[model samples]
Target: MNQAVGVVLLSHSEELASGAAELVAQIGAVNVPVAVAGGDAKGGLGTSYHRIQEALEAADRGVGLVVPPDLGSAVLMTRTVLEDHPHHDAVIVDAPFVEGAIAAAVAAAGGADLATVLASAEKARSVRKF
Candidate 1:
């Protein structure tokens, strides 16, 4: 069986996660799991790490962790989680906030590899009309 490739979005609010989830859902790839880790400060990174851990474990093959732009402390929080759980099979990707989620969804549906997914994301970002 093909292992599942999941997406994890770390944001300042649950709404950001939900928006990403909605985009992925719209793309119609139900096989890959999509999760969101928001506002880690409230419950501490431990809570967020646990949440991310479960998502990563379920992913089996690997996961792409997305971060928003200008997210100062959240980056630290996520890094701590990554360091504490090196055994977890996942890769961290620095994704542009808007394009990242859309790219993730499109890639997941297209069954593209992580590098391809990331490339696609960059392309999408670069091709802005504005």
Candidate 2:
């Protein structure tokens, strides 16, 4: 069976990242590979290359990975980690962190492929909040 796409939430705060992941679960994104990459090695508020790498490994299932970074620093860290993994099927999408994570997680849970999942995440950038 084809594996579902994975979604990673990269944030500066561990609590924020985990809370977002929990929200995805509450939204019925069951069985999807959702990983949280947040905080530094000391468990404080900061992005870490190591944490991002760990999240990538845990989420990836040979299908693809969609990471939505919560801030600029997280984005940079994710990018640096991804650079080392040249052959990995992954992408750092420029989208709203929570909204994109929920969208991507739902799509992945529905067994969508990489392209579809990627598009779904980016589409969250247009999500209406009004």
Candidate 3:
């Protein structure tokens, strides 16, 4: 069976990451794995390297992993995890957090490949609100 691409949402606020995961679940009826790593163990407004690592490990299902970070530190932490853990198929997308998560989830739900899922997240950069 083909596993759907996994998604990891990183944010400084636990609410933001969890909310985005909920939104992604609501947007599609697919069984893609959606994980959230937000804030530190103390539940403060900052990225947690440990939390991000845990999320990545939990979300990865041998298919692939896509991460959308909410802030600069979140991105940095994600990068550090990727480098240290060395999940070659995993990618940290440079796109709007919420939008990218939504897009990536939809694509993953459709059984899109890792590259396609990453592209879907990156495509969110072009979305314009008028």
Candidate 4:
């Protein structure tokens, strides 16, 4: 069986991350593994390296992992976590938080591989409304 790619959503607000995950599930990616890492240990609006690390571990299920951060600091924290955990099969995508997570999750639900899922998330950058 093909392993579905996993997604990790990072945001400064726990509600934002969890809400995005829920939206992704509602959008038909319920089977895909999506982990959320948002807010600090004290439940403040900030990213936590430890929380991100835990989310990464939880999201990765033999398949590769995709990380999309909601803010610049969250992105930096995710990068730091990945740097520390060099063996993780993961990539950090530069894309909008909600759109990227939903796109990646949809691709993953279709059993797309790591690269494809990452591409899907990055592709969200070109999404425009005219």
Candidate 5:
């Protein structure tokens, strides 16, 4: 496993991604790469999809998790990205936004297996509210 796992936090809002980045930074000195795809407000999937692809490509060899603000968009993007990357080891999760991003960053930094990290994140979201 790589010593450092890159994380891409996909949010419509830069501030949300920034907040997640700040939280992840607090957890440890991990190189969690955050890319705010579309603006905070609800935008078309196309806008975020292209940016997400760009960010994912940038985080090569690193696991990725999508942290969208809303459920519909989150679900849609997760399905699209995962279906497109069926064989990828990147941890694409649809858990709560900030907490999921933080968990992913910690798991990535710890070199935790993508499956384990994703499962942990999914379970950990029990405490997260939206």
Candidate 6:
């Protein structure tokens, strides 16, 4: 089986990021590399570039990474980091934060490729909970 893709969640709140990662684990994605990049350097309610960079570096296992950002600024910070590190096999998938992270983890645990894993996360954007 192919190596599992990784997930990096960017959130303004550390608890939110950690909780989502915990959910991924609780759902049996123990093998998936799930990293959380939340809060700012001061640990306040803001995204941190350093945290995002560290998370991407730590989560990547030579396969790829699907990053889901919680807020608009989180996306901007992640984009800047991605631009600086073009060599990293990662992509910013515009998807629902928690839903996308869970989907990505499940797909990756099932041995899906980078593209397929990314697709799984992106598909969460259309999920209807009604």
Q: Which stretches of candidate 3 lie above 4 Å from their native place?
A: none
Candidate 4 displacement at residue 55 in angstroms: 0.1
In model 3, the clashing pairs are: none
Ten consecutive residues with minimal summed lDDT in candidate 3?
Answer: 25-34
lDDT of 4 by residue, 1-130 (tens): 5768889999999999999988998998878889999899789999898999999998888889998998888878888888998636888889999999999999999989888999999999999956
lDDT of 1 by residue, 18-117 (tens): 6777777777857666766654446443236565555445444554533332155556666676787763545555557657767765776677766666
Better of 4 and 5 by lDDT: 4
Under the 3 Å rule for N, CA and C atoms, how many clashes does model 3 have? 0
* Per-residue accuracy of model 5 over 1-130 as CA lDDT, tens digit each: 3545556667656566667777888888455555555443355333365566666666555454434343456457755865785526555566777777676667767767567667656776687355
Off by over 4 Å in 2: none
Specify the poorest-scoring 10-residue window by lDDT in model 2: 79-88
Q: Quote the positional error of residue 24 for candidate 5 in Å.
A: 0.9
Q: Quick one: RMSD of model 5?
A: 4.1
User: Across residues 31-109, which tens digit of lDDT does each residue of candidate 2 receive?
Assistant: 8888999899899999888888999999989899999999888877787888896527898988899998988998998
Ten contiguous residues minimizing lDDT sum, candidate 6 = 81-90
Q: Candidate 3's residue-wise lDDT over 1-130, tens digit each? A: 5888999999999999999988998887259988889988799999888899889888899999999998888888888888898888888899999999999999999889999999999999999977
User: lDDT of candidate 6 vs native?
Assistant: 0.91
Q: Which ten residues in a row have the lowest lDDT in candidate 1?
A: 61-70
Quantify all predictions' global Cα lDDT against the true fold: 0.59, 0.89, 0.90, 0.89, 0.60, 0.91
